[model samples]
Target: MIELDNVSKTYGSTRALDSIDLTILPLRTTVLLGPSGCGKSTLIRLIIGLIKPDEGSVYVEGELLTPNNIFALRKRMGYVIQDGALFPHLTARENVSLIAKHIGWNRDRIQNRIVELCGLTKFPVDALNRYPAQISGGQRQRVSLMRALMLDPDILLLDEPLGALDPLIRFELQTDLKEIFKTLGKTVLMVTHDKGEAGFFEDTIVLLRDGCIIQQGTLSDLVKKPADPFVTRFINAQRSPLESIQNKADSKVF
Candidate 1:
C-alpha cells in the first residue's frame, strides 16, 4: 500500500535515486536487492520520511506524506535498521518499550504488548533484563524485531536486518522472519544485498543498479528471463564456497 511516483533523490554530485517509480503491494513481502550504492536504503528512507525526495511524491495508504503528517504517518509503519540500533545503555525490555512509553502507553498496556511481542518474535522473557552487549547476535536481532513490532504497525521495513549476523544466525533469523511475515500478513518492504536471502523471503524482487531498477520479478523469472545482461551476471555471481570448491575439483578431474 505504498507508492513512489517518479521519485528522485540527489546528494550534491551523486544521485541516489533517479526518476524511480515503484509500488509495494500490501500483504506481501517486497525486497529491494542490489549491490552497494544501488539506492536500496535510500528508497526505504524516502518511504519512511527520513529523507524527502528531490522530485515526485511518496504516498502511503493513499495519503501523500507531508511534513505535517510525517510523524503521524510514520507511526503506521515499523522500521528496523541494520545493526539493530539498540540503545546500549538500556536493557532489552526498556529498549523495546521506549517508543510505547514515549507515546504515553500505560504500564499495564506496555507490559502486555512487550510480552505478546516476545512470544511472536521468539525472544525469551528471561533475557528481558539483559543489555544488547550481554546477548548473542541473534538475540540482539530478536530484541530489535520485538521493539519494531511493539506498536503492531501496518507495514514493516527492515534494512539489511541480518547483514551483521553470522551465517548460522542469519539462516535462523531468515526462517523466523519468513514465518513471522506469514503469521502477521502485514505489508513488508525489506532491503537486502544477498540474492539467496532475497529469493527466500521476497514475494517480488526488485533489483537495482546505478540508482535505477534493473529488473522486478520472482527469482525464477530473473534467472530464466533476464531483463538485462547485468541481471544474469548478478544472479550467477553469488556462488557459495562449496560451489567454488566444486569448480576447483572439476578442473583437476580427468
Candidate 2:
C-alpha cells in the first residue's frame, strides 16, 4: 500500500535514513524494529509528509506523495503518537471529532462516528466529557485511537502507541489492538523498540541500524538466521521480568 524508493533524509551532518527502500503491504501489520536513533520515527515522518525526504520519493498506493497532494493524502491515513497528543483544553469527544468537524461533517455523522469509535476502543461513553487530565493513561491512549480512527483511514501509523502505559494496561491494549487490526484489516506500520511487541503484532519485521535495513522477515526468521550479530543481539537483549524469573525457575539456578 506504501512504497519508498531510495529514500534518504538528513539533518545537518547526521543522516536519518540512507538510500532506504521499503514496501508496506496492504491489510497487514508491519513493525519497524530497532534501538534508539535507528531512524524508525524518521521513516514514519517521511511517510506522513511531516518531513520530506532529501532524496527519492514516497508513494501511497500508486501516487507520489508531494506537497500539493499531501493534505489530501494525509486524510487517508491516521496517526497516533506515544503521549496521545490530545488537546488538553478539548474534551475527549471534541478531540475525536476535531478532524470530522474540520472537514465539515454534519452533527449526526460526527456523533455516530464518536459513538462507534468509543465502542471499538472500549472507551467509556460517560468519560467522553472529561478532559485528558481527568482520564487514566489507558483511557488517554484509547481517546487517541478513537480520534485517529474517526476518519476511517486506509492506513494507520502508530509511533509507540502503548509505550507510556503500565505493563498491565499495555498488555491489555496490545491484545485488543491486534484483534482490532485483524477485524479492520487496514495497512498498519508501527514503530516500537520492544522486541516482544514486534513479535506479537508484526506480520513482517524490518530491522534497521545506522539508517539502513539489515533484514526484513518474520520473528522466527530473525531469531533463527540473524542477518548480522547486531540483529541477534537486538532480538535477545530484552526479556520481560516475568520471563527472566521463569527462566531461572526452569533452570533451578536461583
Candidate 3:
C-alpha cells in the first residue's frame, strides 16, 4: 500500500500540488486522469521520490518514504516515463540487460533475463540484436517496458506510456499491457490525459484539477454519478454510448 498524507509542493509562488492525501490499493491499476498541468506528473514525481514534498509524508507499506529510504524503495518499484527513454546507441537486448548488470548479475543471469523479458513483451528475437534506431516506436516502447520490469518490482508507475503511439498500435499495446498486469497482479499507478485509455485500463480512476483531486472511484461509479460537470463532459467525450449519441445528432436527415 502507498500512502500520501497531506502532501504539498510549491515552486516559489506557484503551487504544483496542494495538500493532497491519498491511499493507493495494491495489486491493481489506479489511473490519475486530468488535463495537462493539473499535477498528475507532479504526483508521479513525488511518488518516485524525484522531488520531495514541502509538507507531509509519503509511506510505502507502513515505512516512511524519505530520501534516505528512497534508494532502497526504488529497487522494489518500476517507473516508465513518457516516450521510450532508450539509449539510441544500445541494442534492445543490451538495454533490457543494463539493469541486471548494474545489480551485479552474471553474464548467464543477464542473458536469461533478457530472454525472459523478450518473451514476456513479445519482441522478435532478431529485434533484440538491433539498436533502438532500428525498431519501430511500438517496439521501442515495449523494450522500455521490459527494461522497467527487469527486476519484477511490486509497484509500477507509468507516465503516458502509450501517449506517443499511433491509435491502432496504442490500442494493441494497451491491451497487451492490461493482460500483462492481470497476469502479474502488480500494483500500478499510471498518469494519462486520455479518458478512454483510463477507463479501459484502470480499475480505479482519480480525477484531478488545479493540483487537487476532483473525484475518485470505479468507472461504473463515476459513469453513473459524476462528481461535477467537468467529469461528466470528460466521461461523455470518451465513452462509446455518448459518442453514438453525438454521431446520431450529426447524421443527415434526408
* Model 3 spans with C-alpha error above 4 angstroms: 238-254
- Which model is ahead, 2 or 3, in terms of TM-score? 2
- Model 3: how far is 203 from its true place, Å? 1.3
How do all the candidates rank in terms of TM-score, highest first?
1, 2, 3
Residue pairs in collision within model 2: none
Tens digits of lDDT, candidate 3, 24-56: 999999999998888998998898899999998
Q: Where's the lowest-lDDT run of ten residues in candidate 2?
A: 245-254
lDDT of 1: 0.94
What lDDT score goes with residue 206 in model 1? 98
lDDT of 2 by residue, 4-78 (tens): 999999999889999999999999999999999989999999999999999999999888999999999999999
Steric overlap count per candidate: 0, 0, 0
What's the true lDDT of residue 33 in model 2?
94
Alpha-carbon RMSD of each model: 1.0, 1.9, 2.1
